[model samples]
Target: MVYIAGEEMTHYATELFVDQWIKPYFDISTWETYDLSCKSRDVTDDKVLHDAVEAGARIGAIFKEPTITPSTVQVKEMGLSKAFGSPNGAMRKGWNGITISRDTIHIKGIELGYKNQVLFERHAVGGEYGAGYNEVGAGTLLTTYLPDDNSPPFVVDKRDLTDDNNVVVVYHNPYDNVKELAHIFFGRCLEHKVTPYIVTKKTVFKWQEGFWSTMKEIFEKDYKDTFLKEGLLERSGNELTHLISDAATMQLIRWTDGGFGMAAHNYDGDMLTDQIAQVHRSPGFITSNLVGKSDDGSLIKEFEASHGTVSDLWNDHLAGKETSLNPLGLVEAMIGAMQHAAMLDVEKHPDDASKLEVKMKVLNFTETLREAMHNTFRYGQGTRDMSGPSGFSTEDFIGKVAWRLNR
Candidate 1:
């Protein structure tokens, strides 16, 4: 676990996730943590984040919690170097994590804002998050890709600016990462038996075509035969489908019955997933994973809660008040990491029948843990956010879940 605790609740929330959920299922020796909280990030000059990524790469999987992304005020208050970039992005790139998958959370019988499981697989490496931009006096703005001496400089874009009236931000996506993003997307859809919707606005930015084009080419070439053979899309009756990102948003808002997945570009995925998180109830109800391919083309995955550090709840905790914090997202992520690790462990010892028993045990525990949580919420034993003032405190709520697990 790479926990970047922030404010108050995130720290406690992650701790509760470990104690109430994971500790009951797996040995404490199975995991460790790297603190990338604001202070830790600053103290290590952000080396800690990189180290965590390296550790994840070595271990094959990691579970992370939301950390504070310092702004100018935070930079000064925390007395940091420059206001650091998002730790998520840093780890994403370092881990070669290309696809971010988030699933909606629904509790049985409880009115979650939306009930659908909306899966978003995004192009993770290059996008607005890692763009180069500057405030300056402008004339003609141009983007030039100067290759090695063997290749000519490719002028991708150029624009004439009348005055200092324009500021430009730009980035380019790598085709390799885009391709892997498709592979993970389609493969997971197949695993879950859900329809895959490739979402993009190639209608506007021609560059956006790369997203849909890669997904289509790969789906047709590699997955089409198996997908059709399995009758995966029999209900929808489409081999491959594309939706403009804008219209897809509408479909998602109306996506109530809950069985579809979508592939989107980075910025679009970043924003749309947040909307889905809310529609599905709260960010606390979302399970996020960063899935990527290694140099050997093997898959690499890291799981995290879809939400940020719960600064508001942390504030209440700071005030020394009894606080109720939803640990569901964090719990989901830890289970995901365990599942991933278990799969790898099984792969390493495929002939060892004992490992399969371990897999079954871990998965059974994971499902039981989830059922207990939802059952708790169904009977209104959740935190304040879900059940209002009548809800239980953080520790107490998880204790109810733990008790259910014990039974």
Candidate 2:
């Protein structure tokens, strides 16, 4: 893993992983870290941030911290002091929002389908689940799977539903690529015959609000029947509403109870996703899929771990101590990514029997990883570090995971 340290604190993370977790598996000589201090960023003329983004696009995995600086804070504090400054705040916003626009269709026994068929299927599945916290509140295990010849007949069709019984609500953040995310999300709703609705404060931020408006227009023009037929358009005495941010948050709690599919903006998504993940009791158990852009349409693409860098626990590793830093998130990310990759490969070459083998291997790996973590905790076999009452070191935790994966 290549890390760009955005803060002095983040440097410890690189040190902990390189020295303890990764070095034991792979040689550390090839690994490197880049310091991206505010001064260094200024010296490089913001090119560093752009370079980091491009690198992430290329490598498909990059961890970043929130960029903070005295000047940035000063500008925010001064607010209207800069009479000649740009209308937006001086603190540069990172492009943390993912741009997802393409759609992919996975039919259980069908092959050689057109892009239109796939897209129609995706859009039909729209808004099957409520947004963020509401998503978990609605149910657990949101997945779409198909049967393969290599898998047992029993396992293949276990979760398959004849009709679209699930609704998915997405909560996007302010910084996210709203237009692209909406397209992909809505496309999925349509594919699954679910109703998708977006909640935004576009009525106020008209100038900076092109994203949500564009999504609403697309849905209105392209998916009018699906939305209307689902009784989503005029619910509870109001026409299908596009609500303000705060209103949407309050409404989500009520809608979760009533069963409405919603899509939230970026910040709300971030905060609420965390809330839902915590409520699920296993943040590592949450599976996040990154739907990437495609010329054909939306794709059920990359998936990754949803947790953070674990800075607090990494501190213990720096002092040559152990910590119980969970590796379940990383393990799940790798497994999910591998499964998605295998599915894409299988779609491209249906004759490839090896793809099914690889997919099964990846699934088994996920189960094994989970079992290892569970067994290690159950047996108290991992080392202990006295940072807190738990007294588990970061290395000890990662070591436990590595042992499980290798076993």
Provide the TM-score for each candidate, comma-separated. Answer: 0.91, 0.47
lDDT of 2 at 219: 70
- TM-score for candidate 2, residues paired by index: 0.47
The segments of candidate 1 whose C-alpha lies over 4 angstroms from its true place after superposition are 1-7, 224-239, 351-357
Query: What lDDT does each candidate get?
Result: 0.79, 0.44
Query: Residue-wise lDDT of candidate 2 within 39-90, one digit each (tens)?
Result: 5555666566566544434343333332334355544653523223210012
lDDT of 1 by residue, 337-404 (tens): 87887787787789999989988888888888888888898888898789998999988997898788
Please provide the root mean square deviation of candidate 2 (C-alpha atoms, Å).
18.2
